[model samples]
Target: MNKEKWAIVTLSQDGVALAQRVAQQLDDKMCHIYTKEKYAKQNMQVFDTDITSFFRSIMDQYDIICGIMATGIVVRAIAPNLGHKSSDPGILVIDTKGDYVISLLSGHLGGANDAARLLAKRMDAQAVITTGTDVKGSMAVDVLAEKLNCVIADFTAAKDVTALILNNEAVALVNQENCELDGVVLPNNLELLETSRDLEEGKYAGVILTSMSRQKPEFAIPSVQLVPQKLVLGIGCRRDTPGEKIIAAVAATLAELQLNEKCIKAFATIALKQNEPGIEEACKQFKAKKVIIPDAMVQMVQSRFDGSDFVFKTTGLYAVSEPCGYIASSFGKCLLEKRKMNGITLSVWLPEK
Candidate 1:
């Protein structure tokens, strides 16, 4: 499920029953039902404070918030606690009678729009989505970015491109690297392009760029650059190496490759180095997932690349970075075969389409 933690809350007696029903439909491990002390049942949690305070208190704790009361009540309770769409939790509102499920806040990036549709199906209610792209049956750029595990370089440009697509204006799709769009059908307004070089200046209303490189092609029209997080970095470092040095080395390597650091999806290493502070700190600084490659997998894949006798003698594996990166990327394309600097060795891998 996209939302790991969900809070189903209501202020009225009727809402409590619907809230409990919603809680039943959701994953029990991730769902919690809450109501005021006067209306709360034995199974539902009672709020110790006011409804506004209770909503504000749990805003950051849950990935999704479902309100069963009036839409205005949910709005006022969440208004002060709202943040940017990128960081905010998905907010959905269901009527007390369960007639409509509304996508209230942080729709695309937060997955509220999808959640509303799914929840409405389970509740036998209609999903009320007002986003222009959804209403017009056009592709939402932010939703597409989320599906591709990408970050949009310019939010304004993304909005413009999405608007153009909704209006059925000509838009260009420039896929450079790392985005798996093999069989995916794009919007009718989007003209699929093999390269930006073929794009004529000012011909299209906007451009949707999918890339991993830091350097992108210049377009005369409004452009939205989608940088996919597809790079996996496998690292081998000496014990007790300071995190600062490891972070610097990674930054330097990414700069040399001319790739955006944000594109790093994970930091992979042998299980032995997984506990190293340097590796852990680098993962934290880059906000990437930590992938601990077991020694057996490394051993199995070591023969595919150049073997290092010294590494095998020291770590019981032929090489660390290359095998770890290969396995971490699900045995995909190897971008950078092991590069060593100082006592550290590193490799980069990208998942093949």
Candidate 2:
């Protein structure tokens, strides 16, 4: 099923034992346990020692860390090396006694809260979620949007609509079947009347929820457009280039394309020896995964090149390339040869219909 990777670190023997059990419960493949003198061994990968090199080495490899057993010392030792907190992976701290679960870093942003809750349930312990939005049972659209990788166009309107929902007003809109809502006034006369009006009129006061990309009919309310923003960035760079130059080119490219840094879900390019440095650097800068294609595949794709090919080759979506005269010229021949270079070369696609 391709579960997300997680790293587990523990210092005390009891902590290490608990971590091993939790790893088994979660069916995790990569778990690094820090312990002394190998007391008891489980299915998880155990690293017997407290050296800084050991901690740094594991941190560099895994994106998320689920800390179990040890709390103060383990967190203190590893906290300094965790640069760029915003981009770091989820870090959850659990008590050795299996009584409480706490999300330390990337709590809501990186799914740490979710992970902690899930782990707590397995241990029959309390999931201590202190986030106000979740506790109030109101709409947490922004948090959901981030977790789902979707774009929310109108932030102010979203908050206002959520406020209305929390007031026990029946707002006209759609919702996921599994959505959590409390004190919702469903199918009231006022909501029904507003539902028939245009969304721009501000008559409706609810959110329109759908996984599909098609726009809904006018509902006389402010709509928060929820569309997945994953994009594939196609990069063409010189051989053996430094990472800085590639990052600069990508920054310029994103700016030209009117795209956010987070919009880029992945990177794609033809396999080139010199392109590795730049590609690696760009991945780190954008926090994106790089998918390198064989030269033969690149050639075949180029033969059928369209501006969308730039994005498709990388992310399997029709995306507009960041406009760069130099980049365009270098790849123009392929695009033109395939008769794919229309006036609108770059285009972003919503998910499949």
Candidate 3:
């Protein structure tokens, strides 16, 4: 199921028509049509409260809010609720005639720009993107990070780097992971450094540093660290181990390894630990998928690694972390071998090459 919630808000009868059209172009399960009582139709939600109140109520509930009304109306309704760019929902405003789809708020990190462009194409309307980078036809730092599924370490640094790029200043890209730009065309002013060691101070106005480790090398110029979320964490905990302990253990392991928590994509464990509260809570807290490897699969991979008789007696498998991580990650290399902590053993897997 598409988990992203999209709210199509309309104020007038004509606006409702536009909203319905917008909803038709979006996933029906994810998109909702909301209008005033007089303008509401069957299967459409009616707002009994004032427009401002209604907008505020759904601000946190929806990932994208498309107001089928005047641009000024959306600005006024969402202004009070706006806090941070990364935290706020993407706000889009479309005219009643479907002439233009405006990317009003959270253009980059919130994905308003991309959403507006896609929606505009579907509705046969022009997309109005006002972001400096987009308007200038330059690559946006946040947009690149979003495409790579990376977490930006410093928003201020990202903004500074983006501004430098917009000003025609040279910026160095230290892509340690060889992170592909995919089909994105690079701005002429942005230069790619072969490695982090090639990032010389004062050579570029700003730098985009992409790496998995948090311990960054000291650089004189402003730099934005992009940590790709590509690692899978495999865990094996004793029966009845508390969730808090599992969480703490995982945190300590990441801290010791100088890895970002956002890099974890899944928490894999033996099938016996699938119902464990500690494993479930750890996955929930980290917002990672829970992968359960059956005992038979674990046995198949056990011969490749050292095993413990105690674990075999408990779970009918000699190894848990390594085998579970290996299977969960489609037989990827183990970056961190099993490390034991209070009643918990954990391992980290590298992303596929």
Best-fitting candidate, scored by TM-score: 3
lDDT of 2 by residue, 1-353 (tens): 55677777766778777877777777754555555556546454656556455566666566567666556765776677676444567777888887888877666656777888888898788887765555665445556556455545556755665556656555555433223334443423223222233334444456555322333344445555544445555555434567776676656545655555555555655444224776688788877766555544454444333445555565443322332211323332221111122221222222121
Rank the candidate models, highest TM-score first. Answer: 3, 1, 2
Better of 2 and 3 by TM-score: 3
Task: Compose the digit string of candidate 3's lDDT tens values, residues 1-353.
Answer: 55678999988988988887888887543888998788889899988987788888988888889999888888888888787886788999998999999999998988789889989999899999999999999987888887777778778888898889999999988888778777867899988887977866677988898888867667788788888878888889989999999999998999988888877889999878889998889988876889888888888888998899999898888999999998888999888999999889999998676
Clashes by residue pair, model 2: 197-220, 198-220, 199-220, 204-220, 239-274, 240-274, 320-346
Question: What range of 10 consecutive residues in model 3 has the weakest lDDT sum?
Answer: 20-29
What ranges in model 3 sit over 4 Å off?
Answer: 1-4, 27-29, 50-53, 238-243, 270-281, 284-287, 292-296, 303-319
TM-score of each: 0.86, 0.60, 0.87
Question: lDDT per model, in order?
Answer: 0.86, 0.55, 0.86
- Residue 92: error of model 2 in Å? 2.1
Cα miss at 228, model 2 (Å)? 5.0
Q: lDDT at 95 for candidate 2?
A: 85
The true-versus-predicted C-alpha distance at residue 273 of model 3, in Å, is 5.0
Candidate 2: count the clashes: 7
Better of 1 and 3 by TM-score: 3
